[model samples]
Target: MPTGPALRIDLFLLAGLFPGLTHAAALGAAVDYAVAAERAGFDGVWLAEHHFSAYGTCPSAVVLAGHLLGRTDRLRVGTAAAILPNRHPIALAEETALLDAVSGGRFDLGVARGGPWVDLEVFGTGLDRYGHDGFAAALDLLLAGLSGAGTVAGDRHRFPFREVAMVPVAERGLPVWVAATGSSTVGLAAARGLPLLLGMHDDDAAKAAMLHGYARAGTGTPRAGHASTHLALVADTVEEAEAALRRTMPAWLAAAGGSERIDGSAPPRRDAGAYLEHLLAIHPVGPPARCVRRLAATVSTTGVRRLLLMVEGAGERRRTLANIERLGREVLAPLRRLH
Candidate 1:
């Protein structure tokens, strides 16, 4: 496993809000995951935000963050990225401040420009409609609001307000993160001296380029300097892990609209065996040792100390908890010594 300065390990929940799941049930499961994380010594739980999709059910990751923060004593709760354009900056700022106060500053607010056509439509903003200027405008309001400043007429989400400060000012200044994908976004975040909430799909070399870009821009570490990783366990055998990856990832990708299942019985998409071969070749999936090596290569490339593992969930409570337990012991426990 990769070793270095202490890594801040976090868990990112991408549990699908499939049919027959009540909102209450979903919230309950999130709580359970947080409780498990804290007990197992994970650093934080990062909730993902999605609109009108079974891929991610958490409509309000901040709301769930507060709930999780209230439930766990030490575990930090954050949004993977709150769709900034979909909400008024004032609302996002106020809620973030309140959560920070109650959690004693354990909340990390990650703001992003919303995308994917359906998500835009859910908020009546088309994919083509929400351009960088609009996102920057919203981001400006958010940053200003976080600094407890008020807005004027130019704000797109809300306009023409007084020296408005974020009510219930944050206990202290909260650590705010911007989600970065492309070079422009990374540069935008670096220019502001803000750390990044990075995504997980890029290869090590690609990620290294992004990291170096951030470094060339300036050093701003996200929550003790961690990047996110897509994770799973294969203690018994690599083959078994491959099967799970093949089985779970396609449905997840299809649900999130990243890929499709053109035919259930076809090769590649539905064939877990075929898909598993391709997946393990790229991502952090293997027996504990290989997983650690792949993940370490990732950390070394990115030079970020924190890792939020996006563990795959097949909608089973026991399976989710079990995956957490396995990774904590098999993957992270050994690495914890470096800290």
Candidate 2:
């Protein structure tokens, strides 16, 4: 349970609007969305990284965060996740340090051990290399480098120490978050006391199980926060919300992997109607009152202190931003009162 005020609200921007979209347009929209989120009083703005797909245009979240920081004032910018296995820890540490310095210590570093079989193939890297041990090594290395401790020597590589400190270390150490999907990764994150960034695609049951496992594993030190990301839209009525969701769910589902049953047997065959309902089930989408209730229930059930809302979908950027503003003003405010 969060021992403070209402759960902190962060806005997430999926790099591109949908598959087959223009990269330039997506980048512009992402920057615009970050600015809008800041104006809406969001605590932070998260950018997701994906490669070799229209699923996301900004393949490098570090660079995207740099751009966003220059554009927005007082908004914490970060990668929803930068796949750690694809890059060396030293370089990643340098980039993140620079981001923190340039952003005036407002950069949050969220890392993951990549995702999907295809993403690994695109990078020409095998998951076997980074499975669990490599992830742990990378996490330790990044943290050590960020803390300006010493050269990090892992099972894979050894860094020569020559008084090389990762530049621009913030007065306070960076908040490191790990993106966890599987049980092993979740347990590792908890054991390390790193914040957990729950993936966007998992269902409610899987989310609950993961959270339970994390809680059980996280007994020692409480060094990290827990956050979950979900797509959301607020409208005048459930019917209107469903209609908007219906327009975007098919493409997103197809991109994730068509119609194949997920772990919980949710997301009925990749068809239009089924996919829309599946998305709504996993997200908060509806009128303000209904969405607030759903969000509160999700928070209570998952025990996540932070909620990252994905305001961008396959719909028009204007509509997405408008919905986010509506959520902030109407939905989130009342939910805060309840809390």
Candidate 3:
């Protein structure tokens, strides 16, 4: 068993349109995953947002969360992130407030400074808002709106508005997490006393550094717990786990090729095989014992309590369900004993 604190395991749903599945089918599988996760005794489920791509089908994470919230009673549903650059701050705040009220505060709002994707043009937020300054401005407006301030204004992008009180204001500052991939964004989130949502690609050391940076920049104490994502799977053997991932992830990664920057400068395409190897090497993808070891290392090294595991690497819905069952029974059960 792990020598560290027990984990609060949650499932990370990409709502991915894997090979041989329609958009509707992919969404159906996501719903099943959420319901199954709650039944499996997961703490929560986070939904990822992607637009105009087969890599992920869910365009609006907030909307998906609303549907999932109605489907389950005890499960906490959140946007892995709702893209901050793609929508107005007030509109997003209002939606978050409504969901928080209806769900009895089971709803979490995690926002990302989305890339320079075509989503910016489609949403008419422009490419400028994809930068650091713009994201800071947008985040500021969002905080004000959620904090029950009578009026809100923007600094750099200058989205100024008159004195307008937010209706159905959050009883307290609603739970908010900012997705941070770099030190700059981590510092931005920290200065405001907001917890971060770290991605899966980074290793334990890198994640630890980000957390340390946030601690240094922010107030002595954090407002809420920070969250991190990881690639996870549970099977009978290491080879079996690797085989399942090798069979499915290549196609999904291939579909996710090419950055969607509107500036007409496309980054080089990714090599699926190489990337998959890197992910397997970094994450936990073996049997229950091995999975526990890797996860415990993360908790010990980074001091993070919440982990969102991506278990859909097996592609098929039945296999994904089986993975969840095994993880809950074989992995989570043992880890729970550690606490």
Candidate whose TM-score is highest: 3
TM-score of 2: 0.87
Model 1 segments beyond 4 Å from truth?
1-5, 18-27, 116-118, 124-129, 148-158, 218-226, 258-279
- lDDT tens digits by residue: candidate 3, 126-170: 977888888888888899888865555554335856666687787
lDDT of each: 0.70, 0.75, 0.87
Instruction: Tell me how far the alpha carbon of residue 9 in candidate 2 is from the true structure, in angstroms, after superposition.
Output: 0.6
> What lDDT tens digits, residue by residue, belong to model 2 across residues 40-135?
778888889877656677889988898888998898887889888777677888888788777778888899886434555556555653667766
- Candidate 1: tens digits of C-alpha lDDT, residues 242-271: 666566656555656532222223323245
Residue pair clashes in candidate 3: none
lDDT of 3: 0.87
Error of 1 at 143 (Å): 1.1
Clash list (residue pairs), candidate 2: none
lDDT of 2: 0.75
Cα shift from native, residue 9, model 3 (Å):
1.3
